[model samples]
Target: MSGTLRFLLASWKVNLASALEYRLSFFLLAGMMFVNNTIWLFFWYLFFARFPVVSGWEIGDVMLLWAVSAGGFGWASVLFGNFPRIATIVSSGQLDVYLSQPKPVLLNMLTSRMSVTGAGDFAFGLIVFLWAGDLTPRGCLLFACALLLAGVLFIGVMAIAGSLAFWIGNAEGIASQVFGGFISLTIYPTGIFRGAAKVILFTVVPAGFIGYMPIGLMREFDPGFAAAAFCAAAIFSACGALLFRVGLARYASGNAMTMRN
Candidate 1:
């Protein structure tokens, strides 16, 4: 466990160094994403200005929603940066080199790169939290928990979508759509979604669990919802792992040169 953790740290160090090589570009990308998110918030501000609340959600709730959504995605992208690209990697036969390595293929592929824009996302989350969220110790802890569950949900769902490449060739489009839909769903309050839509949010996509956390768990501290959220994350992660491992059996090699360790 310690060795794996050390390797992950080393990989992050190397990624940071590489990102630093083009410091200006990195900062520009991160900064641009931050600004982009802020612009969306401004639009929300306009809406709220006209109508003070939507489905019991005020500006502060929306702010926390963005924080959890972006922060969770930020950490996932920064750490396991390859979650959304798994289908492309698998379909393109790029897993060949990773398969030959002594380490875990999934871990190796995930940590191999860092997302420069994700730094801005992470920063935006913290900044929003400081500005809008409660700063008490318990609130901070719950917020952290929300981030963890959100990150896990993002990675797990994306991985499951990507692993479909083993059965269907070039599943990138489907994965991309899922990614888009999940991101869109997470930003809105779950209350706005009704009946079947709400059910699908929790079951089919599981975005509701994430979208609900800011209200049910983090802001209000509902034990049942908190437990449900944790279990959902675990289930998604397990399912993703199972699918990826099963799919690995079907991996086919390509023309790319690969070194065997």
Candidate 2:
């Protein structure tokens, strides 16, 4: 366990160094992503200004929602960048390189890359949290827990979606669509949706686990719901790992030459 943790830390360090090698490009990409999130928040701000509340959610709730969602996503992407690109890697036989490594294939694959824009998303989340989220001791603690749960859930869902490549041959398109929809759903207040749509968010896409975190976990502290959300994240993560293992057995090798640093 210690060895694996060491490897993970080393991988992150290497990724950071590589990203810093091209500082100007890194800063530009991160900056653009931060601005992009701000613009979306601005639109939401305008809507809330006209109507102070939407389905019981105020702008403050939405701000924390983005904070948890974006912050969670950013940390996951920065640490395990390949979570979103598993389909492409599997379909292209990129698993060959990971298979050759002494480390666990999934862990190695996840840590092999880093996303520059993720830094922007992470920073944006922190800024938003400071601007609009609860600042009490309990509020901060709950928010931290919410961020962790959100990150775990995101990685788990992406892993499952990406593992489909082993069966479908080219599941990249499907994975992309699922990921896009998941992110889109997470920013909005779950209360806005009625019966079926609401059910779908919790069961099918599971975005409700994240969308409702601000209210259920941070703002009000619903113990029952928080427990459910925690279980949901754990279940999704375990399911993803199981699916990837099943799929890896059928992975095929390719003749294309490749190298990794």
Candidate 3:
């Protein structure tokens, strides 16, 4: 375990060095993320300005949802940015080198790239969340847990989507579309969703678990729901890991001359 940690640290250092080589590009990327999310926030602000509330949810509540979802998604982007590119790696036979490595292939894939641009999103989301309201001590604790669980579930879903590349051969578009749909669903209040849609989001897509369920727990302080969300996160993460391992078994290297690292 210690050796694996050391290897990951070394890999992160290498990735950071590579990122620093393109310092200007990195800064530009971060600026773009900040602007993109800020625009999203402004859109919500406009909606609230016009109506004052949407289905009983105030602007502040909506901001809280954005903060939880964006913050969680941003963290996942930094930690699992390579997920969407897994298809490229597999199709190009780059996964062969990872398979030959001593450390876990999934861990290697995770550490392969680190996007600092996501840090901007994380910071902005957190600032919006904090500025939106003054929470009690208990609310703060629950919010923290909800944020952590949402991050876990987000990464797990991405892993599952990326694993589909093994079978589909080209999964970038599918992954993006699927995650984009989830983001759309999250931006709105879950109450707007109906019986069947809610069921589907909770089970098949699990988008509701990302923000809806967590926010529900935050509003009502339902320990049972929070427990269920945590359990669901574990189940999804385990399923994703199992799926990756299954896909790894079918990986075939296309390049004969290039050696595994």
Output the number of the lDDT-best candidate.
Answer: 2
Candidate 3 achieves a global lDDT of 0.75
What's the residue-level lDDT of 139 in candidate 3?
70
What's the lDDT for all of these models? 0.90, 0.91, 0.75
Worst 10 residues of 3 by lDDT: 252-261
In model 1, what lDDT does residue 106 have?
85
Q: In every candidate, how many clashes are there?
A: 0, 0, 0
Question: Which pairs of residues collide in model 2?
Answer: none
The candidate with the higher TM-score, 2 or 3, is: 2
What count of clashes does model 2 give?
0
Where is model 3 more than 4 Å wrong at Cα? 133-137, 256-261
Residue 232's lDDT within candidate 2 is 90
Question: What TM-scores do the predictions have?
Answer: 0.97, 0.98, 0.89
Segments in model 1 whose C-alpha atoms lie over 4 Å from true places:
256-261
Model 1 scores a C-alpha lDDT of 0.90
Query: lDDT (0-100) at residue 137 of candidate 1?
Result: 95
TM accuracy, model 2:
0.98
Ranking of predictions according to TM-score: 2, 1, 3
Candidate 1, residue 170: the lDDT equals: 89
On residues 1-261, what C-alpha lDDT tens digit does candidate 1 reach at each position? 888899999988888888789989999999999999999999988998998988988888899999999999999988888899899889989897788877888888888878889888998999999999989999999999999999999999998999999999789999999999999999988989999999999998999998887899877889999998999999998898899989999998577654311
